[model samples]
Target: MSGDFYSERPLFGGAISSTFPLRFQDVSDIRQVPDHQEVFVDPARDESLIFELLDLKHDVGDNGSATWFLQDLATEQDAEGCTAISKGRQGREAQNLLTVYLANLRLKAVGTDVLIVAHEPILINPLSESATAVGAGLAVPAAQSGCMAMGEVFKLAVSSFKVNDWSLFGA
Candidate 1:
């Protein structure tokens, strides 16, 4: 994480931008998917970034709350030890915050009912306040594992993800 550098890479019609090591390929064009807004891959780092949109009308076979939507997703992956984040005295969390995924999880939620989802495999080190999925449930050097150093980069991409065009999700 020391001495490494990063630059901005915008995606999804410039609605969001993220910092990568300036080496990862921005496959946003050639690797296009029907519902995916953006995709970036860094094979050297064995890492990937995927930004997807879920149209409530088209994607959900049944009308369910965002929590149920996310729960179904977790169940598909057989994700173990799934837990919701602690709530405040009001029994609610930050606006739109629905879930904190496993191993340095994400704050998943419905972005304007469009359900913009950002998925990443990263482990968070609470003491250091960084994230990445590598070395999760194990002790190892980050540099050797290659995931520890990507904590900041992952955070940047995720925190910046936004739905610039609300219409895309329908009015």
Candidate 2:
């Protein structure tokens, strides 16, 4: 996917940073929210990345833990394959732990509280006729294929996430 020509446009000033393909469009205002920070779309692939900040203390149910929060979100999307990836502080703040998860969704919402959130999606296409018939590419293999390259690209994007400031919650 990412060759030598990719570029990253930082988001949220010096507070948080990550990279997305330069072709993506910043559509933050489309779903304007007081906390709905940013949204980027890769038009060619129908994929997207969205970032948000949420108030777990005030968000509906006392469903305060990341697990509960994701569960609540799952209600709206009916997504499958939800996997909790990480949970802990996003910075040095003690106000709330940042959470991360992965899911396959037709529609979905994910958040962190007192949380900083990001949603990155990769569109899945059916495997080639030969591979689909043989059921290969289901798990990663030594051979380099379009799917493998795409996975590496997304892995880099997810791994690139970092919190640069804690002021959103406290000092």
Candidate 3:
């Protein structure tokens, strides 16, 4: 962790940004990811950070939204032995907007640590046609060395996430 360097990296054409280790390379273009997602990965460590824009789930209340999404992710990825480690809201003003969750799961025989940051925008983006939620997911291989550093990276990324241009969400 002491040897690692972190800085703010732009996403979605600078409309959004987060602070993370420079070791994570932007792989969205190479991977042909969806338009709504920005993906970064550190291949050597088998770790990744992804930011996604999604249609708001009106049925899901704010209080436990992070946990709900974490479970949903576990299901989507077919992860086994999923265990919720923690969940909480962000800042006072962001209480209504941000919810985060951390979990541990086994994916494809690898134990992984996953952190999810879920944000519900105050306004829905017309261009996105109801894409009102901004979500970030960090996945780090639990068996790897520097797992603790990766955990710190995940926290920093989530905490520093910002939306520079609301229009990216069609605001």
- How well is each residue in 9-105 modelled by candidate 2, as lDDT tens digits? 6667657676655655776645553443666654433334555555444444443355565666544433434422111122111111112333221
Ten-residue stretch with the least lDDT total in model 1: 87-96
- Strongest candidate by TM-score: 3
Collision count for each candidate, in order: 4, 1, 0
Q: Candidate 2's error at 122, in angstroms?
A: 8.6
Lowest summed-lDDT stretch of 10 residues in model 2?
A: 89-98
RMSD in order of candidates: 11.6, 12.6, 16.1
Give the C-alpha miss distance for residue 81 in model 1, angstroms: 7.3
Error of 2 at 119 (Å): 7.2
- The total of clashing pairs for model 2 equals 1
Candidate rank order under lDDT: 3, 1, 2
Q: Write the per-residue lDDT of candidate 3 for residues 67-117, one digit (tens) a residue.
A: 777778755544343422111222122222112234321121222122333
Overall local distance difference test of candidate 1? 0.43
Local distance difference test, each candidate: 0.43, 0.41, 0.53
Off by over 4 Å in 1: 1-3, 56-71, 77-142, 145-148, 162-171
Cα lDDT of model 1 by residue, 21-126, tens digit: 6545667556555554465655444344555554334343333554665676555544444432211122212111123321211223333333333333333223
- For candidate 3, the lDDT comes to 0.53
